[model samples]
Target: MTIPTLEDSGQGTGTAGEARRLAVRGDLTMAHVGAIAGPLRAIPPAGHDLAIDLSGIDRIDTAGAWLIHRMVQDWGAAGVPARVENASPDADRLIAEVAANDRPVPCHVPRGNSALDQLVRIGNAVFVITENIGKILAFLGQTLIVLAQTLVGRRPLRWHAVIHQCEAIGVNALAIVGLLLFLVGIVVAQQGAVQLRQFGAEVFVVNLIGRGTFRELGLLLTAIMVAGRSASAFAAQIGSMKLNQEVDALETIGMSPIEVLVIPRVIAMAIMLLLLGFYGSVMAVIGGGLFCWVSLGIPPVSFIQRLQEATPLSDLVIGLVKAPVFGFIVALMGCYQGMQVTGNAESVGQRTTQAVVESIFIVIVLDAFFAVFFSALGYN
Candidate 1:
């Protein structure tokens, strides 16, 4: 790399060289960029072989390396064989890295096909549904296994937790459940009176209210409300435990989260939903009776007689039988989603919402199935 060069004094000229080649020198860095930039640009670029010596460079950095690179590119464009000599190994590596990374990245462009896009969305939705169903079944099996372990081993069901949960889910829920059912009952009786009066059948309002309240609306609405309230609560509590690593800590210590957390809620909901369903049905009946007595001039005693005569014991049995089943589905969905929650606050909130949605959906689907089954059995 022997090339004569002037000692740099921030002058943009290279050292005097044999006329056959141009040379570069000085600290080719950002700080000295202005001194070198003008002189380098002013040099003629011919489509011929060219050489430059960097041995005179006192120091170099990324900016200086880039500047040298840019000059070489310009010479290359003009068909000159640009050679950089005597650069430090570090400077050489930096320059090579920058050049390699300087190429433009390839981008993917989506095609415009509305039909294909819709098909893709439909396929994805089906896949997600199937995957969710599989997860729920797997979790249900795991819960049952844990329940058997509790029954067979020294670990027993946590009654204290179940009692507390029952109070929370049942006792605390009663007021709202009663109030809403009372309103529904009033609406039913009012509507039935209006429609039946036109047909000279106004006295049948008690029968209308009683049969619907006990057989379907009572337990169905109770389950929906529980799905909205307790399902989210279950998911949120377990999700928070998961987020805080408490669930993992329990697992690490060889304790079952399902036994400790899930079973109690499951038992509580199972017991409470039955009680709540019956209670909700009674409240609805009372509310409907009140409306019938007030508006239709029917005496309370007469309304009770009509209800007993028209609605059989089958309706009450149906509602009670569905309660535990609905509770089971709600608990399964809530606990499965909670267990799915990862160590993130966002996931906790997301799983809680998903739990509520899934619980409500499953309850409705089960109710539909029960309706069809009872119809097939000629029980309703």
Candidate 2:
């Protein structure tokens, strides 16, 4: 077989100067295409049209055709018209196919009006947010339907999965939740005592601790912790299952992925957050009481008496009422983001981060709304 070679045909000097020509000789297969590719691309733009002669090619393949098509495209892009000439039927067909498959990269042109561009970007962002909110609402409806079915005995509750998730979400998280709330309680008591001591009312620090812990800190902080820990875990687990097509496999076996996967997680989060929230409140109160005993010289008994008198049943009720709702929001956002994952590992990571962020944001927003609502009802 002849070795592949690219030879430059001398430029014509006629009145109408002919285009420069590059003739490719020998087998233009994968094995030889690489050798000739460099020289072909090195041909200078002599301020004339360009022609690639392929008739001298002993054999040709897709690789060679691609090389020829790329050379023509490169020259054309440089304002030098280029074409293939004297190609055999097979070579011509292959080159044509390669050329047809070459797609130009899109160029982004800046708009003249900066304000208009900004407005367009803002509109697109708003559209994406609205679309995502719609999707989340639809997911919420589907989950509710599945939950209702389970409640009515139409769908079987997966007790095993629920128990597993409860252990993972609540039991495993107990230490961190208790520690954080305890520290926060001590800080709040110290700060409150400092302020109240100015007016010789340092004893009222108990009221600050009790009311704050039961009404807001305990449940709100616990929910945020759970959102960071359990929400990200849920998104990662479900997203991985999706990437592996295990979700599809369940569907193939006539199992509803939502019923099997989502319901158990949601139920477990609701149940466990209730318990965790109460436990966290007790821990915070204990920390505050300890701080008062050591720093403010208020004995435990005195602190307890003041706490009872100052923190009402209404405050406790408000916190408990918010727990399960916050839990549901966390679980729903995680699962929704998980279900949205597609493509690859990067997508799973993105969804997991989104789940954590969205869960915490929604939880805080709802907490604010609940605070306003209860205040209107005279719970403050």
Q: Highest TM-score among the candidates is held by which one? A: 2
Cα error, residue 69 of model 2, in Å, equals 20
RMSD of 2: 6.0
lDDT per residue, candidate 1, 1-380, as tens digits? Answer: 22223332232233344223455666666677667777777777753355666766777777777777887888888875577777778778888987877776759775779999999999999999999889889889988888777778757888899999999999999999999999999999999999999999998888899899999999999999999999999999998888888998999999888988998888889899999999999999999999988899989999989999999998889889999999988987888888899967999899999999889988998999999998899887
Model 1 clashing residue pairs (backbone)? 5-15, 6-15
What value of lDDT does candidate 1 attain over all alpha carbons?
0.84
In model 2, what are the clashing residue pairs, if there are any?
A: none
lDDT of 2: 0.92
